[model samples]
Target: MGPEGGGDALLRLEGVSKRYRRSGLLALDDVSIWVGAGERVGLMGPSGSGKSTLACIAAGLLSPNAGHVRFDGVERSGGGRLPRGRSAAVRRAWLGMQMVFQDPEASFIPTMRLGDAVFEGARYLPRFKGADKDRLVREALEAVELPGSYAERFPYELSGGECQRAAIARAVIGRPKLLLCDEATSALDVTVQAKVMALLGRVHRELGTAFLFIGHNPALVGGFCDRIYRIGGGRITEELEACERP
Candidate 1:
């Protein structure tokens, strides 16, 4: 089923469930959620509440034990079976979605230059070579409020905030229709975090991208999301309109 409020939904998770075998613990049980095109939703929970697991399943990185994930009304990859030889097609569809991790430092290769790192996944585009790639790299950096000169510097040379912005630059350059941010701003200080959140708001408004923002901060998520879902005890305990939250 699609989201109830009536716009064309970009992603839907129906009766989704997942469990880990080692301890036979259920991480998510009969979870259902949908994200409308250009909508921003936030997921909040205490640690070990399956927040990241939900993100992994939503991003097609992990298959759910049961149920379905749909993107644009068609079933997505990872959480369900695909038609023969259509796995690549599913992956291609996912190319328009990106995930930003809690720790940006862990997502990048220490050996790769920041520019190459940002443009790595986009190499498939025929026009993405030479000067064009350079131009994009510069534009992406600037989009994240980073100076152009920072592109040549490696990840280690950047501060924590800069590294996180670089990770965001990588996701935005792909021009993703959906961005799954898993604690993307958690590592930064309050001021820098605000800046990153503002950047995200600008990107979403400009590109019409839907954001599934995952974080533990109620105040932060309250300010940026259209709705908030609280996960606890392996289930969504509450759903609140962003403006109505106390």
Candidate 2:
């Protein structure tokens, strides 16, 4: 399976490839995928099959050896080079994207309070500045079922599930158009994972945010995604529609 009709997609990756220099391993090979606006797409693969690598590349956190990443109809970057000056400025203003990692604790600053970490990104935006920032943060936390008071506590103080919820609050505070979930629920317990999945569903419905859910669990991916891509051996081997799952 390769990139399908994505002219109107919110995120598009074309012929992407990534190779690690130290290990000389090809983590991804000619991978192509797309997530349309408010669409839920899943990437499923076993460990070390390049699922996380693909997620990082999509999030613009890792540079691919070859390929093009387009977001909102604009080319993001290629060949380890990032946009600069005018291009970078325009991108910053329209930065309607966010990513949540598997380990929520790792996403936070160990020394920072939970509230400050959640407000970090929002504070940079014009609408979330000053008093509005606090309100926005509280609203985000509330949406994630986290108490506003929990914001005062540090990341180490919350349980794993609670921390994950906080991480979600941080990601959604900006009302991103694209949300990347890189094994976001893998670290939680089975019961907690279900709760988190439900929460993500609610968030998607309320915000209409497109999602690229990367994980290894077929059951989880099948349950949450509208379409699923099976990535293995560093490439997408199959694609499945909702009715075709399992």
Candidate 3:
């Protein structure tokens, strides 16, 4: 079994269940999982196995028909609560939660400059404006090791790896306490995938962000995650603890 949830867990999904109205699909069934502060948790299963649905609910985008979500010890149902509340607008307020998608191209706005897009999330942070904002934008770009000049370039002007890195940069800029990644490296080639993994490693080890990583590769999960949960048919079927690290 995985470690139990309590006051220390940064995020928790308890007895969570969801059904897609349009498809009449039971996306999740009595699933319970938790991520502790600064911990790395891996969720893995094959495609069409409700991994993305779980991610959506965790991010507070989709409401579950049953069960509850808790962030920072507060339980949320129908939707998640932010620092102050859980209205639709509050959901968008981004209270310590962020997501990184697999397809970076689809996530970015075509017309927006890369720099503008990367720092957009930090606008939600308090005391964020002027020099600090600009500095954050640059720092976020640098976090992914993208060149300063690349910030001014459009997403179309960059390679896939660069764009994906920018997407990660955007996700990390706000310094969200928890990052829910839905196959964040699937679109990149092997080399770029390694780079993204390394970036995520630093984000996990250095920034103290609890990560709920959704992916298919077991090896990758073992390297970065403290615990690995195998989710199947909308429920967690197994939990694998990481091997002792050097």
**Residue 242, candidate 1: C-alpha displacement in angstroms:** 0.3
- Clash count for each candidate, listed in order shown: 0, 0, 0
Error of 1 at 177 (Å): 0.6
- The numbered model that scores best in lDDT is 2
Candidates sorted by lDDT, best first = 2, 1, 3
Misplaced by over 4 Å in model 2 are 1-4, 79-81, 87-89, 244-246
Runs in model 3 deviating more than 4 A are 1-3, 79-94, 244-246
- Alpha carbon lDDT of each predicted model: 0.84, 0.85, 0.82
Give the alpha carbon lDDT tens digit for every residue of 102-198 in model 3: 9987899999998889887777665464546667788889888998777789989989888888998998887888899899888888999998888
**What lDDT score is found at residue 69 in candidate 3?**
84
lDDT of 1 by residue, 1-246 (tens): 126753467877777899988889899999877788888989999988989988888887888998788876567655444545675556567677788999998899998899989997576544455547888899999999999788898999999999999999999897888999999998889999988898898988899889899999989999999888899977989988887322
lDDT of 3: 0.82
Instruction: TM-score each candidate.
Output: 0.90, 0.93, 0.90
lDDT of 3 at 189: 89
For model 3 the TM-score comes to 0.90
